[model samples]
Target chain A: MNGLSLTDLTWAVPLPVVIPLAAAGLALVLWRNARAQGVISVVALSLVLVTSVALLVAADDGPLVLDIGSWAAPVGIDLVADRLSTLMLTVSSAVTLCVLLYSLAQGLADNNAETPVAIFHPTYLVLTAGVANAFLTGDLFNLFVGFEMLLVASYVLITLGGTGERIRAGTIYIVVSLLSSMLFLLAVALVYAATGTVNMAQLAVRLQQIDPDVAFALQLLLLLAFGIKAAVFPLFAWLPDSYPTAPAPVTAVFAGLLTKVGVYAIIRTQTLLFPDGRADDLLMWVALATMLVGILGAVAQNDVKRMISFTLVSHIGYMVFGIALSTEAGLSAAIFYVAHHITVQTTLFLVVGLMERRGGSTSLDALGGLARIAPLLAVMFFLPAMNLAGIPPLSGFLGKAGLIQAGAEVGTPLAYTLVAGGIVTSLLTLYAIVKAWNKAFWQPAPEEPREVALPRGMVGSAAALVVAGVALTVVAGPLYDYTERAAATLRDREQYVTAVLPGGRGEGRSADVTDEARREGGTDRVEEGSDLEDVGPRGGEQPAPPEEETGSDEGTDEGGTP
Target chain B: MIDTSPSLALVVVAAALTAVGVYLLLERSLTRVLLGVIFLSNAVNVVLLVSGGRAGGAPIVDYTDEDSMSDPLPQALILTAIVITLGMTAFLLAMAYRSWQLNQHDEVQDDLEDRRVAQRAARDEAAYLSDDDGTTTLEQEAAEVHDETGDDGPPSSGPGTPPSSAPGSHAVPTPEGGDAR
Candidate 1:
């Protein structure tokens, strides 16, 4: 167990999950007291932010695995704190904290219909908890649980007031999410049957040893499961439909995290378990298709929310492109891209919400001349719009630059094609943003529209995100380095395997497990070993070489006999 | 596990559900479409469950017998899927009800199409009005002839008209300026 005790960190590892959950309970208890619920939510999210930062610092050097209740791996649930997981937690917490504040401001302003403000605080806390859990979970089953936790919460948030527009959008969102969950469940079963383990670490090792055909099928199934959640190419139809209908804060969070969670799962699976670039070529093709189709959809939309939704889908392609390259630089770029996209997308949605507030409707046809009426609101929209379009001195540009650089380094025709696809998507994204600006702000105000006024404190909430987005751009160098380090760690299976499995060494130690094999089936034995080692810290190893090793691992695993 | 080869039965059930779902989805009625989505989702869930093997074996593990455990992972996944589906179904129903209230209709028709038809009719009506000189005015003809001339004629007195002396008058001009006395 690395001679480190869970008590040593003063329960910091589990606090990220626990604090929000407890806060959710408290908020529910204080549901009748709006101010109290708001205060509780703020305090809880602040704690989460602090814990997430501490966890990041603690896990900076390597990964940290916590076996709940000190039970052995595979038997007890595990919460893993790796660079990737902690980074995700950190970003999610920050974005969510902003979103919570925004929602609180929105509720307090009393601009919305007679929905219960009290319910929002608790549900939002639950949603944050779910996101944290999903990012930190080592077990696949727990990942599903985390997804369901947030899905239920989101369903309520999406349909909060039972408003017609919200209901219309929320309905599609729920149905699509439910279907995705089903796909995920089906995938888990196949993976469990094929490898007899649902722990990600164990499955990674065991999956390598399964029959090639079975493994391939299982990989495809898992991809489909996560792909649907992430809104990848063929599976992204529900996103635009559902996202546009939710209230501003709800839409912002969903745009920022929901599909990204799916993308996060894809990244973890592709890098940790199935590192084979060949097997994931299909993903690359899908990435291109997703970018093209999503932008095309965005261009066709006249509604501000719907346009942003499509742009969200389009930007997802960049992350997929980074992951599909299956190189250190590419994966690192993908990580950076994920972080950048989360902030920028959320900020943009918030701005759209503001636009909807000030301009009566989100319909481009109905809105005009907002820039003249409210320049501050225009700034909010402009910054995020430019960031999303990948303009220079913005985090979006840095993220795209990283991906393009990685693609160029790979020097393959397919890689170049993806690079071009990314560029085109960016241009289209800019066009969509400009179109929105022209209709909602630059053009003259329409006659006979509702007199929409920007709500108090809404601008402040949006400004917080804009400031963060700008800060991300300013601090791109350090952030890129961090992502690169994390990606390197992810590429190296040896460090991860050794950390999880007791007596795990660099070489495959099958002979030692032969005895255990006689006691349990081969699948069961492998599963137990992996569960124990999945969350352990990486020992001494250089970061750069893991990239080459990952490539070789992919080649050998696919070509070598089982 | 059911003693029957559940794969065949599973396939039949999935197909039937899908057929019903597709039919419902194609219907103009939002309620039917929502039902179709539910059935379609359930069918997909069944497909996922069946894909993992259908032998009536418990997924729970007995330490004593290693091979006897059925695949519990799928069952766990199915539980979550069901919950998500239920939430989604509720949301959809809510939206259907809301849509009915807003438009007073259950059918999903494109707003753009409706706008286009309305616009075409408006244009045709304008053309018909132009043909009848009684409804057309000299100012309208003059403005149409010299669009760039910054002249829209005098504004009309409409109900709920803003007071002309309002502070924001310089900022915006009325659309009916040319028609008013």
Candidate 2:
């Protein structure tokens, strides 16, 4: 165990969450000043981005741990920042920062300069905090709390303008989310009933000991709860309806990030708690159906926002496919796909926001000759649209390539079908984007404005995001390597369990995993005999792998140069 | 099933509440749906209680006579769930009230676009199911979809449709009124 007194637990672990949370409280008090709100939101998100990047760097050596109130492992709510979480946090914060800039520009353009909607800043910050918390939390209960934070903030964000449609859509969104959360709560209760502890680390050990039938049933409940949130297959009815009606920036943020949070939670629980890939055949079927059916729905839509909303639902299948495979390559590709999708998705939505501003509509039928009018907007839309549709040399294609490669490696008949389905979805996504393009950008001026003036900041934000999407390609090699290492960590479920519950077997259980036993130099703050050692396997003479992942120097070469 | 009596009673209550709740959820009325959600959530809470498996003393054991502590965590989880459910229910109530103020009823209306999309989907599915496999482009299908009820096609230029509930750049209801049902 990392020997530590109360003082040993520190800020490095919780900074990403705490910074925004504290800043949100500050923003709430300063809500009267639009300038203050904008500055506060921007600065707060910037801090989060920087801290998340720093956390990602720090986590390379080992998983960073912060036990609140100094209550150690399985007993207290611990926050862990390992490779997967910090990667998500970093990308999400960057997207949020850009979105904040875009929204501030929107406020200025809307001529609400003085009244600059106070609620948006605080609520947005809270939502970010909730996401960060969900990523970092070490227990199921705290994960539930993290989800509620998201709901509270999202409910406010979804209905910010108080329009009839926004409210109506929000009602559907909230009701669906509430139902999912209720299921999640019930799942948690059952978990506590089955295992005496709510800590994920402890449950990992205990769940294995429970009857296979009981474990499988519990797994299904958890899957069902998160599946709705992730908008998988039959559970996805609410997303397309609710998402398209929000104000453009809100819709953009929601599109870019929200469902990914659900996906992240699913990945964590599936990988950490249940590694056997239970009913994986069923999951692959669901993934294929989700991909094919969702794209068909996207094809049916004529509006840009609605089309993207449908695509958002569809792409979730890709990540789910990775999860279903339950291979190291599959998990790694899933992580890569998530990051790639987030950037590309957010950029496209921001472009939609711009298109809505310039042409006065996102309805494809009502829009034409946008390229002639606003070529910059067209380029912004073009690159990401191509990227999203899996055009070559872009991150989207790269991500799909990785997933398909993984699927090929799996080589099962079902996996082959999903790979084929994935290719179909990609083509349909491109087709959907092109349909929007023909109507909104390329067609002769059915209704072209004499002059076009865009909010500079908003355009800048969108451009920045588009570049970030491109940068994913630029650094695909490194990012893929990182994902591989992260996936490697996930693949060795016992590594995580042992890391979280040190000496988990008993008082004198020697470190069995050789790799973990070797990295003593990097281990810090492990206590020799903390009082919290009452449960689980015991003694460790040699230090544990303090650095979570040893450098995957080979991954760089294997991933191939970008 | 150590505490068979209460667990059995609770299970029955859960089944009944969930059944009624689900039945009410099928109604078009928003209030009914809201009530159903509440009932469903409450039923889930009771089920959560039963999952704790038994009733015993406090979970605190000082190592003397430690048999069972009634698993206080589920009770705690149930408390958190209740608070969250209350928050959600209150929000639902507010939405219902607002809908009433706007439309004079809380009967949820179908999204016009969603209905159109579904109709198109059914048509496409039927087309796919048929042996011909016509291979109609999705763009063609999307463009061809028109309300058979004598309404103008979307990108609607009818000059009568209110902007209300029309999701577009111009979300605010403007006097430019240009399309209608």
Candidate 3:
């Protein structure tokens, strides 16, 4: 294997998953001390961030795979880190760290009881570990495990204080997510039973050899599982209901991470295992519907949090549109869109939380005159709101520009429909944001008022996110390049396959043996007669091989070809 | 004996649960709605389980025959689903209890119409008072002010009541026949 020792393989792969998981365990043990848990959690996440960066640097040209305990091929547990996964890990870790800090500040300012504060750190650490695991895992079943880890942590974080509103929202969130997880599991089982393998690389190799009809069924099942998680079209009703009810930091992290995981899985599955672009036509239409329906929901909401939540649903359509196209540019655009949306959407939600705090309520009727009293808050809210609406000089605009450009490249009637949907959704999002601004800030205060104060830490956290949103906009060019690289890597599986299985090239050469060894061992092998009986003739002299060798190779190959 | 397939039976059960859940969700009682959510979650779980296909054999490692292994992926997935549902159920129960305690009732009503009516009445009262110019008669003004303030002061000048100084003082309605007047 490329003359590498076991030490290099062991150190390279497991750090990203292990650091946060170990920290989670440690956090749980120290759960009684809130401050200690917070410190430990932050340090753990920071380490994850460093490891993700290191992984990206180390895997510059190809993916990295680790088989746990040195087990070979399909039998072992594997962790794979491709460009897309590394990028996701980096972004997730960064966003999670910011949210963790925000939560700590919020807990201190609100003087939340000790128990809930203590629970927050451990759960947050687990959630981080889950996100890392989901991105890094090479097995379908392992992905499911990662998803469950994150979902459970999110449930607790969402319902931590157990207020009536939070509990209600958390209930809906948990039920919907649970349903999706079950679907994912069923899909994995079906695939495993059909193929007898779950390793993504091996599955990619084997699935292409299966029957067309069976492959189609497997593809559909996988789509449904990821679709439910991603909140595409008919599957998205629970998002708006549950997301807005949580604390601002929790909602921010959810907005940033949860749905994006679904998108990541979809990208991986579609690009790697199933490259039939036509199969995604159904998804394109569903993407359009998701965009239209979500924005309409946003238009109907009076609560600030719920409106943002609905808008989150609407923006998911943009990413789906990119995936549906199944082209290099399309995938690149989708990746860029995901990164931009995570920052913009999370910032907007956090700002909404700030608005709620300053105005004494999230309801439009209870809020007004915020601009007169809190211009900084208004500016923070205004920037992300405008960005989310795809205003110029913002990351949101650049992401949409890339998507529309990709849509135009496809040059189909359906493509036009998606473009139209994108435009309409953007307009509706603007309308929603403006409605919130007018009612929450620009209008005069109500006749009778509840006195409200904006906490310094809350403002600070929001400011940090707003700056991040702006930075994304400013660095759009570089970000696009990075995403394009990731997209290219996804489109060309050769680099990935070779990276995982060294010596994948050169047929007839033992993959585990070096060229030097082959040269030295050549003398011993020359004495063995060449078996020509198994080698079939190509309109030339007949080549022969033993019956066993000929029969097994053709048999397995025939069964494998879909 | 019934000849239905297990997959079909699972589908039927899911449908029934979903219908019941939807019906309960429409009810005004919060507790009923919570129960409805629980049923709906169970229905979704059943749907997931059925989607894996009919039961086959156990998915144990080292099994030689492929057909003998039932899909283990669904079981693993359902385990997580069960845990998530438990968390949700607990949260819903807590929320329902809290709502009951706060309102002393378990029902949630659509309050938009009632609130609208109250707003309209308040606006009408304000408009009625503001219609006249500054030259309101003393007795009429006093009566209007008393209505606005929800006071029950004396109807005429007496030991406890101040005498009206304006020329239209007699216009004030007497307490005994105020509505008749």
Candidate 4:
């Protein structure tokens, strides 16, 4: 155990998640001094950004698994940094750092005594921690903890000012989020009940042995939980209702990052845990509906914020579309789109915040002439807006084109329908952005605009993201390679299981297994990809008598809730 | 694996609580909704506990045997979830109370814009389809036409009309222009 040099970089895996959590605690302690909080946030998030990059690089070398307190998988909490997780951690951490800068700038500029500005710094840090943790955790229970941390932080951030509207929105947000979280808990419990372990790779090994009907039921339950959080069609009513009411920076980060986490979880669980593609057909149809319905919602909105919120929901469909294809190109496109969407969406929101400062309202009915007054702001808005709408030479377009190519590769009726929906959604997203543009920037100001000072920090942070969005296009070749590798890793789940749980069962899954060996047991538990000996068809079934067993006592030793 | 009294009672109680909570959640009053959330979270906690299987002896055991001890993981998860739910419920309660203070009642308000958008999508295809500019006038006209026809989905009918007949107007349900009011 001491001689194992392969696990060297495992210690660095959770730094991005940990540093921010520590910073959050520090910021909370120093709550009175906003300046100290700002310094702590920037320095901590910058470090996180650096660590994530390192983690991603190290993961590319090989998946790095860190068992909490040196306890191994299926027992201790695991933090794994495979290509998929590390990539998400890297992009999102970078995004969070930039958003933090923007928020700090906004707070300093206002000098508002009434708002809980100090609390913002800590809560925002906590939110970033939650996001990073979600991207990094190796087990279901830890993943749930990560989500709760991030979401609770978001609840505070969402209702920061405690305004009537903000509070009302917060109520809806918490209620919906709680519902989803509860469902996720139920899924976790059931998974544990069925399989006796919540380690994802262990589930992969054991689940295939379970009855296909029960396995599919579990898959649907998990999908339903993630689906609500991801804001898919018919479950997206909560989003358009609540998002527009928050402060600009809060709204920006929320719009940019939060839903993507859900999408990330969906991508992770669907690929890693349930790899048989049972839900692919259902996901494809939902992708079409979500794209159409979300964009139409955007097009109908008169407020810029609301429009973007709907457009955000609409664009999530593109990612889901890429995911549902369950192919290498498709998953890679989905990953690329997720990264691209995060930057572009956040940039758009930051730009919207700028418009609010200049025009005093995000309502299209109240805004105009920004093109003449703040051409830079208009540029910031236009670039990401066009990118979001998937114009040529932009990252959004490139991502969409990849997904479309993948869909065309499938050439099935549902695939074709999704392609059409993709095209139409992109067009409508463009239309919605343009509508907001025509009203908020191009036309004459409806009333005299407020002469407000645009904070350099807010604009600068926003511009940095805008530049990053453009940079994504400039570096699309390399980025696509990264996402491709990530997606390839996702498709070949065996390597991930092997890397994370080497000596554990569920290893050597990719090797060819003979038909005779699979049918040897004559029970339904033969999972073809896995090593035949590791998990027999009924190898790790729950004891049913969970008591009196110290073997799997990890779940039994509950402690340290803060 | 089979029925145990405590676990069975817990499941039954959780089910009953969730049903009641969901019913109140669907109501118009924010305060009642908060109560529903409270009940629902408590029920979820009960389920979390029951999910660990039937109650057993303490988790700690000698080397000889600890197999009958209750699972500690679900309890931990329940603790964490309960703490979070309590905090969130408090936040919701505060919001509901704030809304009550701001207005005279704690009635949960519908998001008028979302309602308007949905109604327009169903009844007035012209308004829903023809908007890249999001021209309020075009939508207003289509909505009026929709009202005149009183279409299958919903119309911009008068205040006294049923929800299906007047969802578009019922969102604001005021003399105010569209949902912007």
The DockQ figures for the candidates are: 0.08, 0.16, 0.03, 0.13
Give the TM-scores of the predictions, in the order they appear.
0.77, 0.83, 0.73, 0.84
Q: Candidate 2's residue-wise lDDT over A236-271, tens digit each?
A: 999988887777778788887789888998899888
Candidate 4: tens digits of C-alpha lDDT, residues A1-562: 1223334566677788889989999988887777888899999999998888878887886677776775556556778888888888888888888888888887777665324666788889899999988989989888988998899999988766554455556778877888888788877866765565678877777777666656787788888988888899979889988888777778788988899999999999999989999999999988999999999878778678888999989999999999999999999999999999999998898898888788776667657889988889999999999999999999999999999999999999999999999999998888888888888898887666767779899889999999999999999999999999999999998887765553432222211232232344224333332332222222213233442243234233322111
Tell me the deviation in Å of residue B81 in model 1: 5.4
Ranking by DockQ: 2, 4, 1, 3
Report the lDDT tens digits of candidate 4 across residue range B13-62. Answer: 77899899888877767778878877887877876665566666556658
Ranking by TM-score: 4, 2, 1, 3
lDDT per model vs. reference: 0.71, 0.75, 0.69, 0.76
The model with the greater lDDT, 1 or 4, is 4
Q: Write the per-residue lDDT of candidate 2 for residues B132-180, one digit (tens) a residue.
A: 1222343354445443432323432222111222433233442112110
Best by TM-score: 4
TM-score evaluated only on chain B, model 4: 0.61
lDDT, residue A320, candidate 2: 95
lDDT of 1 by residue, A68-161 (tens): 7754345556787888989999998999999888888787775334245766778888888888889988888789889888887888887665
- DockQ score, prediction 1: 0.08
lDDT per residue (tens digit) for residues B70-148 in model 3: 5455556567667766775675565566545433444542222122223435555321122122313322333333211
If the candidates were sorted by their lDDT against the true structure, best first, what order would they fall in? 4, 2, 1, 3
Give the C-alpha miss distance for residue A226 in model 4, angstroms. Answer: 1.0
Q: Candidate 4: lDDT over CA atoms?
A: 0.76
